[model samples]
Target: MKNVNYINESKEVFDVIVIGSGITGGWAAKEFCEKGFKTLMVERGRVVEHRKDYIAEGKGPWDFPNRTKVDNLLVEEQYKIQKQCYAFHDGTKHFFGNDRDLPYNTKKGTEFSWIRANQLGGKSLLWHRQSYRLSDFDFAANKADGHGNDWPIRYKDLAPWYDYVEKFVGISGNYDNLPQLPNSQFLPPFEMNAPERAFSQQMASDFPDKPVIISRCAHLTEPQKIHVELGRMKCMARNECQKGCSFGAYFSTQSTTLPAAARTGNLHIAPNSVVESLIYDEATNRLKGVRVIDNDNLSQREYFGKLVFLCASTIGSTQILLNSKTNKFKNGLANSSGVLGKYLMDHNYNARTTADIDGFEDEYYIGRRPASLYVPNFHYEPTRYHKNFIRGYALAGGAYREDWQSYGYTDGLGINFKEKLMHPGQWKIGLQAQGEMLANRDNQMTLHATKKDKWGIPQIQFDVSWSDNEKRMMESSVEVASKMFEKAGFKNIQGQATERPPGIAIHEVGTARMGRDAKDSVLNGYNQSHDIPNLFVTDGASFASSAVVNPSLTFMALTARAVDYAVKEVKNRRL
Candidate 1:
């Protein structure tokens, strides 16, 4: 960090301006700067430095003011929407946004949970770290089913980029050669405990079509030279990642991409600068810059750039595009297709089933494991097709023994209860569904007619909801998980659909999708705006469909590839 530059105001026109310093924004900045292009990375929140800023790291539940539970009053007033997140707790509450300050409305009967991490690292600091690569099945799902427009690019277009990013990011997993869920460049995978191994073996014997494997994640199971040089270490399995990882064990903007970007002298960052909208120059038919409002104060400023990449989260990027209206494209900037704010999609993560495993009592595992056991989608395979739903889902679960913490308000007392609590209880297995969501034009988000935020930006209102396809998928998931458990000889299998809102998965994607034609999509194959060449969106907003897996790794690969293409286009003087 010799010449690391952080500024609030800048008038110099940069070669690239990246909006939002989360996962993709960090990669965009790193790619451009390393290519010798002067880049400006803009973040709409306060700076969160890597090791020095993890205030809650290395601390246990006892250190927190409320024993790892966020205060009820604070949650009610400030974290109404964010509280719904699985990672939202007192230990990591600082990473979540104050929902009262970030207000938006849902349509009459629909509900949305727009989980936000408003800081320099964005949600990268708070992500669950499950990294997965979508296959041709996902890319071609929309075209085959006619749910949405066809994706202009396919898996081959992104496989090399996935290898590039995965090696640098240090993904840990086994090479499960499933076509629907492809393998990634990986480190040594974490080991499954005795119970989980038994569970996997039984599932293999019973349901051989659906292979059960260890989940892939961005943990440093074995640090490579690239990761070691970046000051990251093997995962210690603290499992408190939302509070931040000081060892850089998990991939986050603060740990990996930001440091790499800052190592180059050409990188400049503007924190606390909330972009109001993109500055589209009608004369050049290009995105010239952006207009932003300071997060703390109400002062306004402008940033000039030759090219701009919107790496803001799916909703945030779409909000900016929807607000950036011009004379030529009044609907939104680069929204010539009239699909800027339509075709919104999110993963259906609602169905859950838990069962008790009666054996493996003598083998008690000690520490927490970073990843879960995953069962990939098998409905697309021959003889395994479904009737009600078109797309499929993946199941994530693990086998765990009940500890003292698992018992709550027990009615036992004295010596009998104390002796019983000393030993680990029966091995329990829990499975959660991560189903694909169909891209529907009816599930949309639009700018409010009159509502505005504190910074005078139009508030976004979401009308997105689970369609019949998603509901049927979740319902099928419950039955499928219970049947799998029964086949594995697990007892007490209870399965039910938890009808959660659309955005609760926090994997909300699309709303500005990439497609083959200009009339049906917002971006092209290169993630460049169909109507504006100099503008690109490499975030989840550019996804055409919600693939049935974690989408962060795809986001990383696309951003790196987009930057490479954007630079070549610039050298050709195309912009």
Candidate 2:
């Protein structure tokens, strides 16, 4: 047994307690500290500084021990769940999670791959950085289909915040006049290669609304004065972003948010502080403080705050609320709606298809671009009709020539194979579909009655799976990809089904959703817990519906908006 010393001393507190130092938490800390609030950020993992901790970011492919190979030991031990991701490897293994240390359960008939990174910067350091905003199509999805509760806020409410964050973060993309995928405040968009440019022109003529455009990524195409002063530089175009960007060219908590917060002189961060639960005061009907377990010394402590921001990832924030059992809220802390752990959703990416293009033998790209082109969703428009599904899917792909890795079956001599691989091969075009998933009551998470983790906390058991709606959407996705390739005059094309389970998209959302009615929602329109005035959840956990677009950009906007409301409420003495 470890030393369980309880340090119940003075109540030295802050104006705000931001839990989990990930993307959203970092934003909350920066906003609150910049607004002159004494903010404390509690992170459950080791602190990793910006340029110094990213040792592997500058390494080349030949410099690695196994030539950037995947280690069998990692696959056997740590990456059983992380293998579902595209960027998991030995060189970047430290950024991912170890499945052995944290374990959860899934229903017997369902499959789920919960990829996580419990670190200082969290998954933001290893994210793809594809920043996009959901349009009115997404905001009105629930009301259109009657799937789940409607989003209390719409695009007009979030558009200003989106612009605010995008300007600071530096998104890069073309300004296409598309309704679904709106353009953002951008730096210079990354240019497409010769073959890719040709494909884009062809697709533009073939399909009207579905224009193929450059990926709107959160990378510094041209670092500004503020970025350079912060020791960040332009992207080197290495495409090894998962190892962590030493140039600070991409937007991570370490590169952008935390540094900004630290400069305010009002931010105090405590890394390796595992938050156990939020302390609720029944007499006051508000959150009083938060209980934390120090990870290094196995000691417990409490910190009081005027406001609490729960930006711990989707499932993590829900677990904290469920563990906070109190007499006032017998079921769970601030779970008056009985929707705390229900309607868990993730974008279904298992319906993707990959194929090879036969032409463009003489064309190739220059440097490694960090993004690919995207084909906007083109299903179930007001004019267009689909027999099976209501919502649609988006397509994103890139053009790449064959490399030396394709010489596995060659019987030729080593030098011959190496020489033959010098020039690029035929251009291969691949497409992946990100389909929207409906919020269902059956897809939920609950605390297990018998299981516990190393920290002696109750483990979470997931009862999540795709329904008939997802199956039909996936079938349509395959057929649509095949038709597009056929129209493009490609040969020997093949479509493969991605074997990923639920939660593998890393876009996990809606465990504690928001709505207008308190009976069906955990949070209000402002992301404040209706049962507890001082508590706010602005992470993906507060989303009422799952949109087809990426959710991180929205999370940033919502966090900024929620902090604004929280600060105002505190000033008014409502919290």
Candidate 3:
């Protein structure tokens, strides 16, 4: 790689330029800078410092303006898409994108919720920290069913990188020797409450294949030397993680990657810089730099780099690429495979079941646990019989006693109801089903030719939808959840489908997928673009299939592995 230090009077350049400073971007910045590249990370919003920015972390319910009630007018005016997420409340509203400021179009008869945070840390600050690895089942699913394209790599390729990330990020979970959802290097799994423990035991006894393990999360249950060195503490067990953890208890860009990258003295961050397009050099057939528009002023600027990592979220990154049309690749930048915005997917999560547990009246646990109990996927085992669907879904649920807030349904006058609510009510069990959404080309995203955004870039129009296969899987998910509740001896069982909408799972994946051949795949095994070897995309965009498990951990592993490969390639002058 050339190390030219030329500062154009108008344009700026760096060794490596990363777009979007969320989880993937943070990792890219950290990796590039640590690997001796002067990195520039551009965030479309303002800077949010670690501890200081978490304003609502220590606040109580009374401290909120509406006493935890979300402002209805604000929801109507600002966060129409963001409100769909349960975490969008008064305390954490500042962390989400205001709909008025960053608006995108959706097709008629289709509802697309693009929940986003353009701030320095991005959605990483407010993400549900549940972490899990996608196994060969996910990578081989495409090949097995002929749905999309086979994954370029398998679980073995990412396992070591998973270890590398888990060791530093501090995941807490039991080592459940499950092949489908592999266990991570954990700190210590949080203990479940009495009712949850009872449910776990019942599930284990009734269905041996489906074990209920504590939610594997990136939150530090017990911080080690590495975490302490990074100025992070163990999780205080406060469930108020979406408000941003002031303790640095959870894994966010502010807590982990950004600080590590900044420590290298090679990181340069340009906040309020919205990356509009990639400057593709047609003669060289490589990405030379990026064209960015100032988020505040709309002023344009260009930044050069030896390499670029498009870590913008699944949809956002693809939008940038699709907009960067050049003569060499008229479809999009590095879109030679014609799969730039194809196979767009998010986990099907509308199938859910909730119930009230009758027992465990005297049992109560202290501290707000950040993790839930996870029942791993039980469908499609070699001997197990699953008639309806090829793929499966997992269950994440837990038991929580009714707090002082449960009195909203009661009509008891005043003091009596208040006292009753304070002590806790019957154990409530709520389970959400996360079913795998197949990678179908018909479920895709395209740039609207006529609809342009404020920056003159075309608005992304999604044509994504679930197939009969996904619907079948979802039906099975509801059945499994209902049965699990019944087997656990829970009453008042209610199962309902919330209906699938685009991007609701926050696990949006597979715009530019990995595959065996350059003609068919946008990225190879190392996340290096098949058409442009110098550029890599290690985000959810490279996912071949949406596995039942969460995609963040897989992205982390892929990123770490890709960074190692990129470093080695740089050392060998292979670019």
Best by lDDT: 1
Candidate 2 residue lDDT tens string, 73-128:
86778678887687887678787878898889988988888888888889998888
Q: Identify the candidate with maximal TM-score.
A: 1
Displacement of residue 483 (Cα, Å) in model 2 is 1.6
Q: Ten-residue segment with the worst summed lDDT in candidate 1?
A: 380-389
lDDT of 3 by residue, 42-108 (tens): 7778889888888888799889889876789878888888888878888998998888767776667
lDDT scores in order: 0.90, 0.83, 0.83
Candidate 3 off by > 4 Å: 1-12, 380-385
C-alpha RMSD for every candidate? 1.2, 3.4, 2.8
Q: Which ten residues in a row have the lowest lDDT in candidate 2?
A: 1-10
Q: How well does model 1 score by local distance difference test? A: 0.90
Error of 3 at 455 (Å): 2.0
TM-score of each: 0.98, 0.95, 0.96
Clashing pairs in 2: none
Q: Model 1 — TM-score against the truth?
A: 0.98
Clashes of 3: 0
Ranking by TM-score: 1, 3, 2
Give the runs in model 2 whose Cα sits over 4 Å from its true position.
1-10, 380-385, 408-415
